[model samples]
Target: MNQNLVIALAQVNPTVGDIDGNLARARAVRAEAAAAGADLVVGGELLVAGYPPEDLVLKPAFIDRVEAAVEAFARETADGGPAFLLGAPWQMRGRLFNAALLLDGGRIAAVTRKYDLPNYGVFDEKRVFAAGPLPEPIPFRDARLGVLICEDMWTAAATAALAERGADLLLVLNGSPFEFDKPDVRLDLARARAAESGRPLAYVNLVGGQDELVFDGDSFVIDASGAVMARLESWDERMAVTRWRARDGVWVCEPAAVAARPVGEEAIFAALVTGLRDYVDKNGFPGIVLGMSGGIDSALSAAVAVDALGADRVRLVAMPSPYTSRASVEDAAETARLLGAKLESVSIEPAMQAFGHMLAGLFAGRPADETEENIQARARAVTLMALSNKFGHMLLTTGNKSEMSVGYATLYGDMCGGYSVLKDVYKTTVFALARWRNRERPAGALGPGGRVIPERVITKPPSAELKPNQTDQDTLPPYDELDAILRGLVEDERSIAEMTAGGFDETTVRRVWRMLHRAEYKRRQAPPGVKITHRAFGRDRRYPLTNRFTDLA
Candidate 1:
C-alpha cells in the first residue's frame, strides 16, 4: 500500500510580542485540525513570536521566551495528535535565524531556517536575523516535507534544492502582507514553484493586521501540474485539511473546494477593516473616536470603524467651525444615524474666536491667509484630542493618501490620531471604496448592510471647510488626475520626464513631485494605516525629509 497523509493548513491572527497568547491560539487550532484526523498541521511564518518580530528579536529575553515556549510546545506533541510545524525566531550557536521547527514525538525533530531574508519594501529581516544556508527536506510520517519560509518561495533556488534532495511536497509558511494585486502574485509564485519542482505544494499564511500591514489569509494548495486544489478565505481565520496520497513516487493533494475570495475594492475595504480592527483590539483600546467632517474620507473612516469595532465602540465628533456648511453638518448627522454610532457636536468657533482675538495684535497689518485657515484645523485637532483623552477612545485620522501626498493636510491638525484607515488609500480609491461599501456589505462586517455613508457625502465636492467657497480642487488638481500623477511618482517611481511623457502636464507633474517630497516629514508623523497599495507611505516607502534632487523634465 502507498503512503497517505493528511495535512492541515491553519491560518491564525497573531498579535506581535504576545508569546503565550500566540501559542494558545496555535494549540487551539491544532486541536481542531486533530479532530479532523490530520497527520500534520502547518502554520504561517513566525507563529510563535509573530512574523516580522522586528526589533523584538533583538532582545535576548524575547528570544528566551520564544525558545522556551517552542520547547514546551514541542513537548505537547506527546498527546499523539497532529504534529505541528511552526515558525519562530530561533537562536542557535549564538546567532538568531528566522526558523521553522518540526515538532513530532514530543521533541523538536528538525529545524528549517529561512535562507531568503526579504530586505526590501516592508521587510527588513536582513537587519535582524542572519540568513541561513539552503534548507533540506524534513522526514515526516510517510512523506518528506520540503519547507520554505515566506521569502524562500519567491525564487526557484530553494524549491529546486528541495526537489533534488527527493522531497515529495513543497510546504510554505508566509507572513505575506495584502497588496491590492498580491493574491494573484502569490498564487503565480506557488504555481511556478510547483511546475519547476514537479511536486505538489501547500501554502499557509498568517491572517490579521500587524501595525500598518494586514495579511490576507488566502492560503492555498497546488498540485504537481501547477493547478490549485484547495483555497482558503481571506481576511479571516480559517483551517482546512487536505488529503494527500502517494502516486507514481510523488505526493498529490486531493482536490478540495476553493472558497471565493474578495478582490479589488472589496478586498481593499476588507483590508482596511481588518487592519483597523486588529490595531485597536490588539492595542487594548476600548473604542475609536474620530472627527467626522461629512467629507468622504471621514465618512468612510467612520463607516470602517463601525464595521470593524461595532457602532457602540465608535464615537463620532463633529467639529464645526464658522466655515463649515449647513450641508456638511446635516450630512454628518445623517451619517451617524445610518451607522447607529454615537455622535457629538463641538463647534470650533469659540476656539477660533479666541485664537483670532489673541493673534489680532500680531496680525494687525497682516491680511487673513492660510495661517487663519490652519488655525481652524488646529482647533479641530484640539477638540478631537480632548474628546479622545477624556473618553478612552483612540483617535482615528481620516485623511486620504491624495491629500497626504500633496501636503494638503495639516501636520498636527487633521493628522493627529492614533491610527488611520485611509492613510494608504488615495482620494479616488477612497471614493470607490465608499460607493462599494454602500452597496455591498463585506464578509464579516459588523455594520449595517446598506448605505452607511450618505449619498450627498459621496457626490459632494471635497473640502477642508476652513474657508468660504473653498474646495479641494481650489488648492489641488482633481482627485482623478492627482491620483494618476501621484501613482506614477509614488508607486511606479517614475521620473518627472516619464510622467510628462505619459501625457501628464510637465508643470503639474513637477509640482506634484515637489509636494510628494515635501510631505515626507508629514507622512513620517502620520498615523499608521492599512497598506492596500504596493507603495504605502510608512515602512513600505522611505524618503529623506530634506532632499535637493527634483527630477525636473
Candidate 2:
C-alpha cells in the first residue's frame, strides 16, 4: 500500500476561445503544485478549451489547436514533477466528446470521456458533443480513481459502477455555474455520492465569469463517511492541496482547512461582483460608465461597479430630466461620494426639448402620455451613451428583473448598454443587496468599507423618474409581491391559475403573465448580465418573439 499521496485542486479562471491562455494558466498551476510536492494536480472540466466552448468545438481548426496544446502540455510532464489530470474537448474517431486526460511520465497515461452531457437550462452540451459510454476507473500509481465529469456526478449510475469496479477514490471535474443557494445543492450531492460509494471524493470547479454565467470555485473534498475534510474559498481563484494516506486498504483524506462559504445575500452579492468584474476585465474594457438616477437599481449598480473594478474605473453620470426630483439628485451624489466614484451631472433637458420639437409636427393633436415618458428615457440614454463612446468605457444598464419581467422598461432606452450587473436581480433582491453592501463589504471588494450605498437609497420609493411622480408601483405591483409572483410564473413555470391558487390575485397574475409574454421582444435586445437566479432571462428562459398562446386559463 502507498504510504502517502498529495492531490492539488486547481480552481482556475479560463476565458472561452483563449486556448493558448488557458494552456498557459494550466502550466502555471501545475508548476505551483510541483513546488508544493504534490503528486497530482486536478483541474476543472474543459480547462484546456475553457468550458462550454460552445460552437467553437465545431471548427476543425479550433479542435486541432486544442489537441496540439494538450499534447504539448502532456509532454512537459517528462520533468518528473507532478502529474496533471486535465480536461478538454477531445476528438476520438470522427466524434467529439468532453474528456479528461491523465498526463504522467511525459505522455497521456489514460483518458475518460464524460458520460452525461447536460442539456437543460443554460446547458446545451447534447447538441455539441456526444455522450461517451460509462467511464471505468482510470489507473494511476497506487489508486484506481473513479472520475465523473460535471453532469455525471448528478446521477448515481456512474458512481455506482466505478465503486463496484473497486476504485479507491472519486474525482469530479466541474464547470458548474453559480445560482442562488447552488453551493449547498452541490455539497449535498457530493455527500450523497461519498456515502453511497464508500469512497472519498475530490471536487474541482472553475471560477470567474463567462459571458452571462459566473462559476463559483467552491472546490471541496468529502471523506468516505460523508464528512468534509477540505474546502476551498469561493468567488476567487485558488489552489488547495490535500494530503491522503492509504490505511487498511482504504484511502482517507487527512483533515485540512475548511474555508467558510458565503450564504444568502452575501453569496448573491459576490456573484454579482465576480460576474461584473470578469465581464469588464476579460472583454478588455478600460472601465464602465452608467447612469446614476438615485433610484435603488442604479445605486446598487454603481456600488457593484465600484466594488468590482474600483472607484476610479467606475464613472457615474446623473442624467436628470425635468421630472427628476431634487431628492433623487442628492441621493445619487451622496451614493457616488460614499463609493468614491466620479460623478458628473448631465441634464437631458436639452435633448428632451429637441426631441419634443422634432416630434411636435408628427404628434399633431396627440396628447402627451407614455410616449413623452419614453422620449425622456431615450434622451437620457443618448446622453449616457455619448459619454461611454467618448471615454471608451462600456455602458452598464441598471434595469432590474422586476422592470424587465413586465414591459415597463423602454427598449433602446434604459436597456441599451454593453452589460448589466443587475439584469437578473429582482427589485426585491436589489433592496436586500443594497442594504447588505451598506453594512458589509465583501471580501476582495475594491470599494470603500463602511457604506457604499446611502440608507435613503434603499428606503426611498423605487422610481424611474421618466415623468413627474413616476414610481414603479404606478405600473407594476409592489416588489415583494411581484418577485413572489414572478418566481412562480418564470422559475416554477406555473400557469396563471396556478399562480392565483398560490395566494396571488387572479387579475394581477393574468396581467403579469401577459406583460411577461408581450415583452419577449424587448428582452431579446436587453444586454447580458449576471445570472443569479435559476431562471434568468437569457439562455435560461428563452421565449419566442412572436407567440399568441397565453396561460390565462
For each candidate, give its TM-score against the true structure.
0.99, 0.99
**Clashing residue pairs in candidate 1, if any?**
none
lDDT of 2 by residue, 1-553 (tens): 4567899999999999898999899899999999999999999999998877899999999999989988998899999999999899999999999999999989989889999899989999998999998989988878889999999899988999999998899999999999997998998999899999999999999999998999999999999888999999999889988999997669999999999999889999999999999999999999999999988899899999998999999989998888889999999999999999889998889988998889899998998998888888888788888988899999999999988999789988999899989988888899999888888989999999998888888898888887778788988888899889998989999988778877899998888988889999999999999999899998999888988786775
Q: How many residue pairs clash (N, CA or C atoms closer than 3 angstroms) in each of the candidate models, in the order given?
A: 0, 0
Q: Every model's Cα RMSD, please?
A: 0.9, 1.0
**Model 1, stretches more than 4 Å misplaced?**
none
**C-alpha RMSD (angstroms) for model 2:** 1.0
- Misplaced by over 4 Å in model 2 are none
Q: State the lDDT at 508 in candidate 1.
A: 87
Local distance difference test values of all predictions, in order = 0.92, 0.91
